[model samples]
Target: MEWFILFIVGVVGGVIGSLMGLGGGVIVVPALLYLSAYGLIGDISPQLAVGTSLLAVIATGLSSTLAYYKKGNVDIKSGLLFFIGSGPGGVFGSWLNGFLDAETFTLYFGIFIILVSLLLFLQNRLTPVDLPKDNRVMMTYVDAKGIEHQYGYHLPIAVIISFVVGCTSGLFGIGGGALMVPAMLLLFRFPPHIAVATSMFMILLSSTTSSLTHLYLGNIEWILALLLVPGAWFGAKMGAAINTRLKPVTVVLLLRIFLLIFGLRLIIDGLL
Candidate 1:
């Protein structure tokens, strides 16, 4: 029963994370913590939860990146550039994660999740930035509908943002797409599909680095991570397929509500 639930958690995390490029850590880390607290799983500490979640996230990133790439949504050039900063940031974040205790991890993760929920709500509301053409490094995409969209960013700024995203990924086991996707949309003017795809590419790279760091620290729960990988991998493919087929507005709204409620629960648990 526990194994079944863990697989389900992985599937759900992969689907949602791939849909929005938000990374499965938002789902995986919290679920592991909750289950561990109930003693349904083995003695899992905060570090183990984060480390295991990141491993699962690697599957999600790799699976989703492949799916997105076939659709021509991935911006390979920009992804490589962003990796310049995100790679090191992920390493640093994983190192930092070692310092956190259970109570502190729960509280901080709760706050971060709430902020992520709010960020999603507010992401579409942000007004577009007007940058001079010469200052912007541009890329253009033609969507399935044959509509062309132009997006660009300041190279240094993009790298800086990716670094911060990577740090959060390493520290929290999130793929860092929650912050990265929106930043790409608002700051870099990336199309939604492009932002998500590119963010997943970045996630694949950073999660690999972060997971290696965790592996060295002996933080990952190997058994749990293995169970999660298959589900996350396939679910990510399903998510990419669903995204290309239709927009599930109702599902997204409900997901936000779940995040809010779950995040609040974590805060209460930490306080208690």
Candidate 2:
């Protein structure tokens, strides 16, 4: 039953996270921790859960990035650029993750959840940053409609933000897109489709490094990661298929509420 539960979690997290470009760690982490707390899974620590969730995130990122790339939504160059910062940040965060016990990890994770939940919710609101063009690295993209769009960011600012988000990703076992997407939308002025697709690409790049660090730390649950991979992979494909047919506003709202409650519960558990 526990294994089955985890498989299902992979599917749910992968599908929703693919759409959101978060790589499913937000869902997977909380689910793993909750199951462990309830004895539905055996002796799973926060580090293990995070490591496992990050592994699943890789599967989701790979699946989603491929699908988005074929659709011409992914900004491969930008993704690589951000990875310059995020990759190193992920390694640092992974090293830091090894120092925390269950209680402390849980409390910090709970706070992270709340912050991520709020960020995801706010992303739906379209706010323009309109940065100075001179200070920005401008990008030109031609959408499916053949309409050319201009977007980009200040190099230093983008790198710094990606680094911080990447650190959070490795520390919490996420894809780093929870914060990245919003920053892309609001700060970097990326188009929605472009932001999400590029975020997946960056996640794909960064998660690899982060997972390697986790492996070195022996924080990953290899067996569970294997189980999660298949479901996460397939679910990401499903989500990408739905991208053209759906808008995620309603879904995100519900996700925010669910995460809010779950995050608070984890906080309480940590305090206890």
Point to the candidate with the largest TM-score: 1
Best by lDDT: 1
Measured over all alpha carbons after superposition, the RMSD of each candidate to the real structure, in angstroms, is 1.1, 1.2
| Candidate 2 residue-wise lDDT, 1-272, digit = tens | 77888889999888887888888898898888888878887789878988889999999999999999899999988999999899999999998998999999998888888887777667667577777778678999998889898888988888999998789889998889988989998888888889989998999888889989999888898888888888899889888877756987777788899888888988988899
Error (Å) of candidate 2 at residue 137 is 1.5
List residue ranges in candidate 1 displaced over 4 A.
none
Model 2 bad stretches (over 4 Å): none
Q: How accurate is candidate 1 locally (lDDT)?
A: 0.90
TM-scores of all models? Answer: 0.97, 0.97
Clashing pairs in 1: none
Model 2 score (lDDT): 0.87
